[model samples]
Target: MPSQITRQITRHVLTIPAQGGKPARKVHYRRCGQGPALLMVHQSPRSSSEYTELMRDWAAHFTCIAPDTPGFGQSDPLPGEPEINDFADAILEFADALGIAPCAAYGFHSGGIILVTAIKRRPQAFRCLAVGGYAIWTPEEMRIFGESYLPEFVPQPYGEHLAWIWSRILEQSWVFPWFDTREEARMSIAHADVEHVARTVSEMLDAGEHYRAGYGAVLRAPRDIPAPDAVVPPCLISAYDGDPLQAHIDRLGAMPASWSAQKVATPKEHQDLSLAFLKEHADTAPCGALPEDGHEGWLELEGGLIHWKGAKGGRLRLHRPAEELADPSKGEIAIDVPGHGQSDDFDDMKRAVEASAEALGVSDIDWPAPPAGDADRLYPDMAPDRFGLYLQRAWQVARAEAFFAPWYEANAAHAVPLTPEAIATPAVHARALARIRAGAAARRWHDTLAQIQGETA
Candidate 1:
């Protein structure tokens, strides 16, 4: 019989007094497991609830602490509309309230931006930092992102725009002109997973409009982190294949000496790498780990966790995946990405990717080559004026398809092969089936001709 996965944990809601003339606010948090301290920060349009599952697995390695950022989840809105820096201050207060003077930290997306800002302001307070898909958009890129990627505020009720919003977030890899390079284009198409996209969409919708503040702040804030060259500490930045931030790898590349960047193909890879790095270096300073369970899966990334062992202490095990061990060039580490398995944070894509690859025992992979052909010309029919909207729609469909394709393919094996009558149930369904059949027939014909020619030779 398999061992039952135990779900041991505790919950707390404490009022953390604001620092520097701000009023106190009720902060909701979850604490579990036993070990060093680790703090988990959630991205925009979501709450700390995102890490609930991933925390289970991490509890074995560290005392996981995940809090709902002010104005999101159960936490109250800030005394006033706050910027990313203000959010960081709230965390500092939260840390003080919990008696965590110096702890390790991890964050994803907007959460990462805040943590990075916090660490820059108080470098000595953190032992190390790991971020997923960190965005350091250049001035030009920020202009484009703001004009296209920022969600428009609509007065329509939540349900009305939920689907549209969800789709927009999911289909980002598809139709988004930002990723014009060949390798990114191919990987984006190949990695589209509709189910995952749908789930992410759903979660965002559930989190509601209050989450928009974080996104807005991220978009408007300047991309500036003073050099940590003087008080450098180990830092990791990671991202997956379809991460929008992947385009700004150069910006992140300029990180201080103590920082490293990596690009990964999936979120799980990011978590594992961050965890391994944290575990290896969790003794030199104070640290905090969130979501204590060693098996609880995280939101979106599924089987993920967060762990902060300390600054530097513990038996460091160098476990690399078999394929990675064979080829030392792959550069994958033997740890899990946060919110994917047993790790946390989602702000720095490159670092996450490199760390994940190392954790998985694979050597680092080269950045993918840009896509071939004229990317701008591919969608001529798309209105130039509304390119962002059109691309956003296309991206939505692509992500939905990516998420659902695997399940659909698996289920197809148990059902009867598609027949004209079966597909004719809906007009849209029939048209899609016809397209599939045509594509399949074309491939078969080409294969048959090749085989015949080979036989004759």
Candidate 2:
């Protein structure tokens, strides 16, 4: 057994041109470790962040790279409703753009289907695959799923879908179809942990309205097992006990000599065996150098990638300033707050701010107050019919002050060292559209605050 190695994980984005003359799509990815590359694809409605822990463990032996599949994270969705093969081809494009090939792969559920399809479409791109769960759904099941499983996941300003999302994630383990309320379909492993629910909600928020396209494609994908005569890369499909796909392993029936299926006692055991198998079949050598961390680029922190601009010197962190209007030249450092601009969001503001500060390589700095009465003005594009516009507006105000909101009063003293020109930096205008896109999360923040105040009062 190889000893576990610690490596600095890095996040970056690259734009890949569309097949036609359409605009390019930006793909965001996280990479770590220092050996042969292992590509990881996450389950639907999730991102590369899902593999952070596993990437850390596998980094000791492989250069683990996890990408946010299109439509699920920062990565852009397909030009139109994609077929499963299109998703698979996108993975190949992702690998080609990064210049890594003949690598091993791992995925979970929808991710498994995507990776398997990718390998089937381009056998030379991968040496082997380890799948956590691979569903082989029947026509009936597919019909049922296609109808309801992935309805348009658009944002409802009032967050009308919040309850549905919460219940769906919580009850998924308890029911086979999740929508089925029949007693016979209930499993024993149902859990309602707040933290877990919050995590799922955060990922869903990241996917927003586009999750339906990606997830729907997988549910509608062909579940064909390679015949013994077909040439395919080595593959291992294992599902942990109690996983919904555990029974589907039997549906795989007869697979090629290069493929194997098993039911693992636990997820951890499954991961261990899969990792070992991938390493055993890995054929490529590591790139020999770790990805460089840039001083003027994005940093992968706990929640999501934190975008930083300006040369390293006197640091000036902008608090919800219009990104386009504020000049990066005015300060040595500037950041896009989580849930704002190019940065990602967390369920909690304190954690977001703390991570940003750490990524900024600053202990403390001058905190400036945001311009008054600008939150609502910044989000003019929000739908008037949205029920939580008020809350979203309030959240925008709090978002501007999130760094200090957790520690100090919103109106507390915030020293202004820079001139009015600096106070009204143009960068603030750059991210207004980004802020509008994050209105759903602002609604979540509203719900969180209501709970907090209700608990205290």
Per-model CA lDDT versus the true structure:
0.54, 0.70
- Write candidate 2's Cα lDDT for 15-55 as tens digits: 78656655678787888787888889999988998888788
Q: Tell me, by lDDT, which candidate is best.
A: 2
Regions of model 2 farther than 4 Å from truth = 1-5, 288-296, 300-305, 309-317, 321-334, 337-367, 370-457
Model 1, 49: alpha-carbon shift in Å?
A: 2.7
TM-score, per-candidate, Cα-based: 0.56, 0.72
- Candidate 1, residues 299-333: lDDT per residue as tens digits? 22223332222112222222111001111122222
